[model samples]
Target: MRNLFFILFILIFVSCKEDVLPKPKAYLSLKYPAKSYKKLHFERPYVFDVEKNATVKDSKNNWLTIKYPNLKATIDITYRPIKNNLKELLIESEKLVFKHTVKAEQIVSNDFINESEKVFGSIYEITGNAASQIQFHATDSTEHFIKGALYFYTQPNYDSILPAVDFVKKDIVRIMETLRWKD
Candidate 1:
C-alpha cells in the first residue's frame, strides 16, 4: 500500500510539472502588440513611421525608430523611384545585415504595388534564428522604397526568447501591409 501511494504521488508530481511551462504562441494574423507600438503621420500621407527611437538611418537614408516602448524594434521607410543607384542601394542593405548577423537563413524577395496608388517595391526578408527582414519597394523607374528589419536575442540552451522576435515580426508585417504612398 505504501509503494502504491509513492507511485501515485510520483505520477501526479510529474504531470503537474508539465503544466508550469507556458505554450509557445503561434504567429497568426497581422495584429501586433498594442502597448509597444505608436503611429506617427509622415510627409508621405498614408505612409507613417510606425516605430520608436526615431533616429537610426537604414540602407536607403530613411530614418528608423521604435513605434512603441519596450519593443526594441525599428521601421525605416524611404520613398524614391529606382532610376539610379539601384545597385548601390541593394549593396548597402546587404551590408546592414551581414555586418550584424552571422548569416541569413531564409530570404523571400517579391515586388508589389498596393491599391492605394502608392508604391511598388521588391520586398526582401532575411530570416535566421535571430533574423531581419528588409523590404525594398519601388514604383516607376525611381525606387520608392520601404526597407525594414526586425531583430531579437537568440535563444539560450533550455529557453527561447524568440517569442519577442516573433512578436516584432508581426509588427513589421502589419506596417508592410498598411503602407501607402499618398499624393
Candidate 2:
C-alpha cells in the first residue's frame, strides 16, 4: 500500500509540472508568383502595362476594373475627357483620396512626369487601414485624364494585406510609368 501511494504521488507530481516559458512569436509567410506584365490596349484613348494574371473588365463610359482574382483585389480605372473641367476633375480626385484619410496612417504623393509621353499626374500611396491603398491620376493636361484606385475585396486589414499591397503597388507604378495617351 505504501509503494502504491508513492507511485501515485510521483505520477501526480510529474503531471503537475508546468513549463512557463513564453511561446515564440509567429507570423504568416505568404508567397506570390513572379510578376509578368503585358501591354493592355483597348479601344479607349490610353494604354498601360498590367499584370498578366489580372483580368480586365470593361464598364460603361471608358471605365474598367483590373481584377486580381487570386488576391481578392481590383484596380478601378476611369477615363475622362478634360473638356475644360480640369479643375473640377482634379478637385474630385483629390477629394476621393482625402476621404480615406480618416482611416489612413499616411498619404504619400509621387509626381509622375514623362515629357516624352506627355503624361503628367500624381500617385497617392495610402498606408494604414484605408479603403483604398493606392490612388493615381494621369493626364496629358489637355484632352485625356485617367484615374485609378486599388482596393481589396476583403476588410481592410493593413497588416494582413501588406504583402499583397506591396505587390500591387509595384504593378501600379509600372502602369503609371508606361501610360501613353492615344493620339
For model 2, residues 1-183, the per-residue Cα lDDT tens digits are 999999999998899778679999998788888999998856778988989989999898889899999999999999999999999999999999999999999999999999999999999999999999999999999999999999999999998999999999999999999998888
In candidate 1 the C-alpha lDDT for residue 148 amounts to 57
Residue-pair clashes per candidate: 17, 0
Which residue runs does candidate 2 get wrong by more than 4 Å?
Answer: 1-5, 12-20
Model 1 local distance difference test score: 0.52
Q: What is the lDDT for 3 in model 2?
A: 100
Tens digits of per-residue lDDT, candidate 1, 56-140, equal 3434244444433354544545544456877766677656656535555656666565646555455565565434545444443
**Per-model TM against the reference:** 0.51, 0.92
Where's the lowest-lDDT run of ten residues in candidate 2? 39-48
Model 1 segments more than 4 A misplaced? 1-39, 44-46, 49-62, 76-83, 94-102, 115-118, 130-143, 153-159
Q: Which candidate is the best by TM-score?
A: 2
